[model samples]
Target: MSQLQDNFGRRFHYLRMSVTDVCNFKCSYCLPDGYHPTGKQHFLSLSEIENLVSAFSQVGTQKIRITGGEPTLRKDFTDIVRIVSDNPSIHTVATTTNGYRLAQHAKEWFDAGLRRINVSVDSLDPKMFYQITGENKFDEVMRGIDAALTAGFERVKVNAVLLKGMNDKDLPRFLNWIKNTPIDLRFIELMETGLGRDYFQAHHLAGADIKAQLQSQGWSLDIADIDDGPAQNFSHPDYRGRIGLIMPYAKNFCATCNRLRVSAKGKLHLCLFTESGLELRDLLQHPDQQAELIERLHAQLAQKKETHYLHQGITGVTQHLASIGG
Candidate 1:
């Protein structure tokens, strides 16, 4: 089979598969109102996911990043990880979580074949973390990170959304933490989603400022791998850990697009900010649908725009980051 290449000649090999849309944290930029179920909740079954992943793997997908509103909320989360990691075509299996369950399940998840982990730790200060996430589990989350490292994950990553007034001054603390922690810390620019437009207006910070500061302080840019996400990685010999910046608003940001998203409900989203997703549940019913599924995926790649309209304040149908596991 040919690679999953788009008209622009960008070959996609990374898949961000969402297993559930239910998140526990109430982050201001995402689900500040918390998660509320709409209609009868029907997520894809394990069999359906296996079939979907198998189809993606057949079409040159090598890195599978299991995502979610909170993927660990599902009882079968480890099984989901094992299924994808067990695929011979898959080279890496990763997941981004809130780290609420990491202290308890990190070892098992690693044993289930998960190799890389990204934990969402927006702030280092306990009070500030609570203010942003509406959860007072800062200390617990820190413990979870230690647990992840102990569970045999080589280098764990922590993601923080750059909020203007909230946790903005915590950067020094983060730097101090990573000085000897060997963690890969990333700061993501605040994005304007349909649900968080007002919040974004109040707290959107450009990641470039942080990037510039890092450069001035002796950090050097590192070349990205084909399967890596949008982060521009940086490193310094003095520091044990590395820093990454994800500036979606930067010019030609989508020029390096190499990943695709699949919602938990079995919809293939060519881009995170696309207005509509192609319904794929109909084609995920059986193993025989693999060929048709791959064909459908290729067909949708043509519809992917050259870039997202986020610069123009357009957020498409994404109400919040959690809706599609952003």
Candidate 2:
């Protein structure tokens, strides 16, 4: 099997595949209210997804992160994990979910070889959580987090998108909660993308500020050598779990990028902040074109931009996080 390397000398080994664009939640930063779902025919079938994963695995993708607007919302969610985990070359399989329905399938997902999970929980306060997610299912999501922990997955992470006047005030509460639990907590800086650019600009909070606040609170932090995607991880002396900061705007990690994204509609996105991609749905429909498709994919990856233009004061990709499989 040949390895896929970009023009910048980065070897791709991870793939984030979105199974569906449909989501139940209407997070203010992700999807707006009354967002329309993609048509069912646009989604790839189970066999097609498996085949695509097989193609990527053959080309040295060892880690597969199943994603979606909400991955568990897909009917074949468990099956998707089972198939991807079955790949001999794929050593790790994980998923990022909103955690609304994770409790019902956590055990099943664990049995299907899923070892890592990232759940998005913005606020611990029910009212604030509802305000941020635009949903009243905070209790359900909390149950889902507990279920993931109870299921005994190797790594269960909590992703909190920090906003200036919103959840940023709850950083202490988040730290206090994680200090007692085994799950790691990651604070992601608000990114300017799609129609949320204005909102992000208005509410964006720098991860550096958050880190400083934590330090001022007497939490000793030591930079840890841990690379999971682009997050800069740090360990606190008082906590059993580590804290992470994903500052895409303040400290971009594009130089060490090693993954690719496949949108739910089968488009191959080389960079999350770029609109350019190669359509692969037609290629997947023909089994005989597998070799050719792989070759084309490699070519497309080779042309990936050296870095995103967000830091240049340019608006990022116009696609919403939901459409991009965040």
Candidate 3:
């Protein structure tokens, strides 16, 4: 019904929903140090988001991921998850979070129907964490990770946004834990966005750098085959556990890009880094317009550009990571 596709055959059927664009910990890659929107923003009601997903599912889109400024920040997050997961057409129900609140919500989320969790745990060091996230809640975040494992969620992933002069050099420490623990640590290439109109061009971290760092540490690795998505495959030398790299910026995974995003405000974004979005708040508010919303989505998706120019450099990404729903 919708037609957002590149010259490549990959069709955009995945939906990355940003329930709320407000995050408690403002990470370097997510938001600028002191960036703020001029006007007050409103979040999409639970019903509004549900209707949009229901419409998308009716069309061939099967994957749905709940993203956020921090998804847990939403008071009705569990209710929202239940609505989408309850839909038979939705094969996967996942979320990308900061993990600051996962410990308390993991069990509830698992019971509600979230099968996959991708949490952003940048570094283990308290000092570095404070440096990266202008906050001091590392302990809480870790607690959430432990809780997620205990909650019975089968696929638990750790997404680390590798930033230059910040956490990239600490790969050995991160990967070391992955080798011992039964968790999959995903190393994401630092993306440019919201607070990143400038500033981060020189600090960009690429997937090659991550690979090189692992090689230098003599950490034997193998590319992982974690179903499908952007992240390049990588695995622990011998352990059953694995690691992933999402080089969406430099390498341009746009060829196999099959994802779409709906913001908390109800606008649907076909790509992560751009400003173009189709407002669905009204369509969701009006049931009769669901077809119109679906048709608009197809048209917008067909217009998806090749790659994101976030940081505005050879390897820069054009959009903000936080706004992109990670």
C-alpha RMSD between model 3 and the true structure: 2.9
Return the candidate ranking by lDDT, descending.
1, 2, 3
Local accuracy by lDDT, each model: 0.91, 0.84, 0.75
By TM-score, the better pick of 1 and 2 is 1
Top-lDDT candidate index: 1
Give residue 116's error in model 1 in angstroms.
0.6
TM-score of 1: 0.99
Worst 10 residues of 2 by lDDT: 219-228
For each candidate in turn, the TM-score is: 0.99, 0.94, 0.89
Question: Of the pair 1 and 3, which is ahead by lDDT?
Answer: 1
Candidate 2 vs candidate 3: the lDDT winner is: 2
Residue by residue across 1-326, what tens digits does model 2's lDDT show?
Answer: 68888989888888999998788888888886845855554687898898899889889888999998888988888899999999888988999998988889899999999989999999999999999899898899889989989999999999999988888789768877878788788899888886876897789988889778767766565553322577777776678777888887765468878889998889999988776567988888766878988988988976898887788766566567888687
Worst 10 residues of 3 by lDDT: 310-319
Top model number, TM-score: 1
To one decimal, what is the Cα RMSD in angstroms of model 1 from the true structure?
Answer: 0.8
Structure candidate 1, residue pairs in collision: none
Per-residue alpha-carbon lDDT of candidate 3 for residues 1-326, written as tens digits (9 for 90 to 100): 54445455667567888887777886766664533553676888877877887798877777789987788888899998998899998888999888877887899999999999988788888889878887788899888888988888888898787788788678767766777677878888766554564656666777887777666755565543323577665654555557777876555566667777887788876666665577778789866787887777766656677766543443333355665476
